[model samples]
Target: MTVSELGLLNILPILILVVWACVLLLLDVFVFPKREQVTPLLSAVGLVVALIYTIPQFGQPKEAFNGMLVIDGFAVFLNVLVLISGLVAVALSYDYLNRMGMARGEYYVMMLFSISGIMLMTSAADLIVVFLALELLSIPLYILAAFGRPKMESEEAGIKYFLLGAFAGGFVLYGIALVYGATGQTGLTGIVEAASGGLENPVFLLVGAALILVGLGFKVAAVPFHMWTPDVYEGAPTSVTAFMAVGAKVGGFAALLRVFMIAFPSISVDITPVLWGLTAATLIVGNVLAVAQRNIKRLLAYSSISHAGFILMAFVTYGDASVRPEATAAVLFYMVAFAITSFGSWAVVIALEHAEDRGLELEDYAGLGRKRPALALAMAIFMFSFTGVPPTMGFAGKLYIFRAVIQGEYYGLAVLGVIVSVISAYYYLRVVVVMYMREGDPETHSEGWLNLTTAVTAVGTVVLFIFSAPLFDWAAQAVLRMF
Candidate 1:
């Protein structure tokens, strides 16, 4: 499609964000000093504007650039989630950066760029677009992960994340080439039509799909492809880790769902088992390893991985026409639930974190309830949410996932899912136990922005649970065109 044929209205949200990010960067350099904090405010304004553009595009799905980019309900739903995550990341980073003496305008710039990439991924209807968008989102995160100069671990995180991420990218690029060679199609809809019509050799198509899965698996931090998760999550600046935990996971799954569901549903026979194994391994490894973590960051990293497993379960039985919508909606709800609670938990981590390891270890959380009751209570709520306990969104998310799996006739997977969630409770509850039951003086920085984020997320966790019916209905509407 020609550039003129690609209507601007279909992509206004992405254009607004990318352009605003560039303008915000210039403003940070020429207008706002480091101490003035103008960049973050401007950054927030840019995100709000982008979100405004996004909401209007929700009711009608449009394909621009010859179907290379499509503005659909799925894209609209995920764009809202991605934009909200970007805003929350900024809020979480503000005070943490100040406390660690790592405040800088570039951080927000990179985040904006990354968020734009995430938005692009959700709307991409082609594999080439997916790969480019993946890189756009990932490179900024690699820089942010190692943004802390002069710290060995931080430097190490940058290098490790960069190298592994590059290798994963290579897998994706090669897979795309193979899939194209096999079917002579690069766009997801084209690929779907080609595969459905019966390719001469299905081997190439199947292998290429597996390779693509490997690449996206790395992005989502699925097991066997998840080696870098714990170290990077531990080594990176805390707020970056928090952002990566949610933003990266959500983006990865968004693309994964779109590409596989929209592009390769014809090969569901081969795909289902792969996702089943991925779901089982990720759930077991992430939760089991989290049980042994001494560092809170590492624990959450594993927790993030385990949550990926739950989301992946929705994909396991997605080939069943009857269950596909529920699977997709479950994923959407789970991502929302996980994102809010993840940030809330990280806010508590930032609140208690001291420079040079003053409040990082699990032991450091002792007596938090006795000291800062509100913060500790927020942390406790996040823990309950993570454990899939009642009166929280996490429970509702798990319930939806389990029901989907069961409806898909994967009863064994559903049962195992419950068992792992039960196992996860022990580790998640440990934080609350340390905060309330144990005794020690845990030093913390109580910045206004930080406290506000915590309370908002904590309240959101329980409040959303009460109103889950409407949320799920929204999610179901979002996937109306998936079939």
Candidate 2:
């Protein structure tokens, strides 16, 4: 009952990252004032340290900070994933920022801060903590989106993201208040316990959950709330777009999985239909709209939205107690698959991007196969993975998700996923076709870290699938403690 009893070490990974970000912020101002390169390296080092701290705590399930946070397999899995994402972002940002004349130490600092928020979100056990974590995760992203100062597009992206993000935050906060009003509890476990005993205002609870879903749907770029995504992705710096694509979705889904599965299962019957509609609409809209885009970033933005729909397919079974663990595991695995494939694709996009944002059109990618065969091959692999082709992690991820959906008896959703995935191939392969089948000189940067990121992620996307069973088992283990 006392503050002294609140375990702190249980969340050491999050703490280390938060403290490191603060220290790095100061170091950026004084020690590395002129060295843009040093900050990213240091940022990567901090993320590695946090990852090390995280990996050791995977099996030790416990609550901390007065039950506001938890350390468990799920938390550890996401913590490690988020940390790795931060490191990859650092690598991608190292040279690109300097090339575009937007190199600033604060860029890395903001990323570190945002990543720490993601780490916190994965472990949050209370609604209050989830709201705090959501804000911490989002605020830095708004600033980072605008990091390319004076550029009209970047400025517009930042402001639009900021305004919309704040509106989404309002939805979450109001939902939290309503949930609290209905159950008089903010802790997820307590909310479930209170609801199971019979909520006096179950309607309030249902509406609140819907509002929270709306807010998170925005974060994951689900349809009806996804208007901000394409503009932001196209306008923001490529490195920021790459990181934001993965990090924000992970954080949003983490909260969504935890809160809905833990706190709202008692009312799943009322909410299951909503999840189904979101999944179908998001999948259909994301892929259908993407076919009309010529800009690569916008296409990938829609790709991100469609992938979110695929993840939502697994989440559609959140109400099925018998299939919940399997669904959770499928979602975790698919996130890893999506992250690897996404980063690799974006790396190729970044390689081809120029100072004034040339090389971004679909036509700009023509002849990339002849000019940069390796990068082109990597892009092809990424595109294939996105299309759910074999030997790639995306295929494995979609397989797991469809199987889980089938197990949950959501055959229609699974079938829709397949058809849309086929639709997605049209645009995904268009890039590859342009690269190999057409003819236009494509200029690309051959930065060491950038190339390494593309190569490693491209390799990981394939290699991990070959060993997907163990990886999936690990993901399964992560949610064993949840229920």
Q: Best by TM-score, which number? A: 2
**TM-scores of all models?**
0.98, 0.99
Question: What do the candidate models score in CA lDDT, each in turn?
Answer: 0.90, 0.93
For residues 158-209, write the lDDT of model 1, one tens digit per residue: 8899999999999998999889988999999899899888898788888888
lDDT of candidate 1? 0.90
- Where does model 1 exceed 4 Å of error? 1-4
Over 4 Å off in model 2, which ranges?
A: 1-4
